[model samples]
Target: MAATPSASRKRILTYITDDSNRKTTFKKRKKSLVKKARELSVLCGVTVCAVVCSPFREIETEVFPDEGGVREAYARFKGMTQVEQTRRKYSQETITEERYEKVKSKALKVSTGNQEKEMTEMMYQYLSGQLMSLPAMNLVHLNDLAVVTQRHLERITEKLAALGKEGDSVLMPPPPPRAPASMDMGGGMRNDEGNGMYVNTNNRPEGPAC
Candidate 1:
């Protein structure tokens, strides 16, 4: 049979007894208190500011400097009419509540209209069973098809040239160079990975990459 082990014992002690431990505790508690203050400011929609000074004279401060709460409290406490007047002027010039609501409503209406139009078109296409079929010729689609044809032609010509090279008796015609952008119906514009149109020429843009 194995012998039984002794039970461990622990005791509670004050943190401030050791100077190093006291300092460490103070640092941790200060950080926790600051975090709690920030959370209170966000959750309760209030502004909070806290300042701490250690025994060695180091000082730290945290401020919630948002629109309401502590700022209003301080303004009221100090009877700062000038500050209130400045705030009112800034708000009027930069962003008024009325203008914000108007812009938001306009954006919402435009987005809803676009979504409805897309949904109606999709439903019509599904019911007609013509979603997969290409219908009604357009300049843009024609230009895309031309580009695809040119790519396939180049591939076929390259294969023929390779075969001719491998068997010296056969001579293959050289593939024609790609047509200039101006000749394409797309007016020199190419689809850049579906993001937007771009000029197909070799010339680089002036600015840095987006």
Candidate 2:
């Protein structure tokens, strides 16, 4: 007598630890599970929801292919989760705001207290002559220092200008010859001589003028 297929096939759950093996097993199991779920839902005509978490805590969903039923279930689940998350977030924000206000108030109070203490010390020093004991400390002394500094700055500027002028004097070119009174044209100068003969300065004859 031949053994039946069901008798040979063992229906037992096995955990796979190897990365590649786990992935292969997960794919096969997921397909089989979804197929079985769909078959059951169609055969029994019942609403079903299935959620699976892999070993890595990643979630996977397999719903009966009924569009309306899947959508309704998803909407309810998502709506509830969103409401809870929003409520928790608002509560956190309220607590944070209260803490911030408390910290801000304390900081202001401490800062004001420090400022008052400093002002009191400064007033006491001003009333006594302790502030005047230091030489060159008063406003008049400061003004005198500023005037002396300004005068020193002016002297330095004058020295720099004098040095620059001396440098320019050393680099000076020879002065050009003054033109004759007749050659001087008030608004425009003519290239030709007043006698109408053109004088080519560039090609001048190598002899003294007659």
lDDT of 2: 0.65
Which residue pairs clash within candidate 2? none
Name model 1 segments beyond 4 Å from true.
1-15, 57-73, 78-210
For residues 1-210, what per-residue lDDT tens digits would candidate 2 score against the true structure? 899999889776566669888877887888888888878888998755555546544535444565677787677657776667567455767988988999999999997667556544544565586665434356864564455556656876788687776545656897755554346343444334455333445455579768
Q: What tens digits encode model 1's per-residue C-alpha lDDT throughout 20-81?
A: 77878888978888789889878998656655656644634434443465567676656867
lDDT of 1 at 203: 57
What's the lDDT of the predicted structure labeled candidate 1?
0.62
Which candidate number would show the highest lDDT if scored against the true structure?
A: 2
